[model samples]
Target: MLNGLKTLFNKKSVDSKFGIALRSQAGSYALDKGEDTDIQAGEYFTETSESAGDWLDDLLSSHNFQGSGHLVLSASHYYNVQINKPDLPDNEIPSAIKWLVKDIVPIDPDEMIADYYDSPVIVSGTQKINVVCSHLTSLKKYTDSFKRYQVDLEGIITDEFAFANLLSHRKHSTLIICQQPFEEVFLIIVKEGQIYFSRRLRGFSDVGGYSTEQLSKGICDSLSLEVQKSMDYFERILKQTPVSEIKVLLPVKHENFIIENLDKNTNAQVSKLDLPSPFEQMRNCAASVGGLIEFERKGAEND
Candidate 1:
């Protein structure tokens, strides 16, 4: 199933040329480009028409940009689940997952692209594998949107994996709570450089016409409960090390309020998420930054 999808772009050398990384949400898109390890340029825009292809053309043409490269799309149209590692050959794992999640997933197995990440740790001959699936129809929509521009898609990755890539260098167990405008908050737990658990919660973003204090309180209350649940599950169900710290990534305007409120509610030390050097203004572009980092890491591995 998804094994073929995962290997679709491997036939090409990732470092042969430069590429563009794109993240879209709520009719808006952000484009990023880098040469070698340095990000040289970035652009953010909103679509005014139904045709995403037309919008992309206007953006690239307006900036006089040209070249074909890998496209990394940041989307939430995927599902992540944990399952026990089956006692089967590597080639049979995909079919096993299809059968396992056929009823769990809304769409038919034939209409989905599926992949999985085996837990870095193997305990008692059992492994926790994170399964990721995206609908074929949604994938086609994204591929078709960029095909008009002759862009080569490197991969379509979920925000969790992209964000995990951004935090790949961290050696400690940590909980990351990311609040994005108009999108569900992503609560991810990472341990030993791998995603241990992940969940998404709604009602954490801005409320139209609501006061800043009111919105902050609502977000803090909801976030507090989710954070506590994640911590308890990590320490009890997973029986792993306790998370050392809780990192919150949100818009700069809400950082101070969130820090103040979240600090009072959670035992873990809460602080703003630190961005990599090239992402100084990444408050609203966290996922895009992560996607760029993931793309670069893949390219380096290929090289």
Candidate 2:
């Protein structure tokens, strides 16, 4: 019932791709066409349920989104984790680990739909992989809404992969830090343009709104430590080289302060990701913009 939740396409899709980055109380619809993009954004009623789809229905109508598209869900919609890759074959791993991680998630993993992506290549006994899952019943509200709005739901990706798509792939590893509205801090290491490792810092929802006092009083320090520690795990545990760069893409006002903080505590050079017009205006939808842009983030051929 829940399929195509990840990047399963191996070929080009000619039809228009509608990429929407969904947050708890609002979202942005992005349609990227090489040189130009048309973006529409709206906020949901504060008192409504996120799964009710009324806000999404309005957004799609406003965009006139009538074709297949990808949905990049925010942290609140799904469960994401890193675990030892099961010894089973690639095709069988999803089913096996679904049961393995059932305990961590609130949903019945047996009934929930799941997908996985490769972690960094560990030259050791067992490799690690990242698993993402969403309950089918809860996800249906999105699919059903798409059907009603005439927008074919092509696929769904977590916010990690969505942000990863915004980067230009380099041979070396790059760690990215991003945050959507009211969502926790997300850290991802993208190696060779694909997701190698990802983490969501709990209790950090909306760090962008942290006041100058909050940032000065150890919040940025804590964030720097968290990022440094994550990089350490990737290098020491995964047996990978130190990351080449660290990029921060956020909607916060004190971007330079965060960058400066990370720069002081980390070996990698820190900087902000450059965003174009619409994206800069609607920073909350950067993931949706990532979802729309065709960067070779999944190791797909650019040709």
Which candidate ranks first by TM-score, i.e. highest?
A: 2
Q: Which residue pairs collide, candidate 1? A: none
lDDT, candidate 1, 24-101, per-residue tens:
443232344435343443545555324544555665556433332334444355777777877789888876786777
The residue-by-residue lDDT of candidate 2 on 200-222, one tens digit each, is: 89877767778878887998888
TM-scores of all predicted structures: 0.80, 0.86
- In model 2, the runs with Cα more than 4 Å from the true position are 1-15, 33-46, 276-278, 294-303
How many steric overlaps are in each model, in order?
A: 0, 0
* TM-score for predicted model 2 compared with the true structure: 0.86
| Model 1: residues with Cα > 4 Å off, grouped in runs | 1-3, 6-76, 121-126, 207-212, 215-218
Q: What is the TM-score of candidate 1?
A: 0.80
The residue-level lDDT of candidate 2 at 182 comes to 76
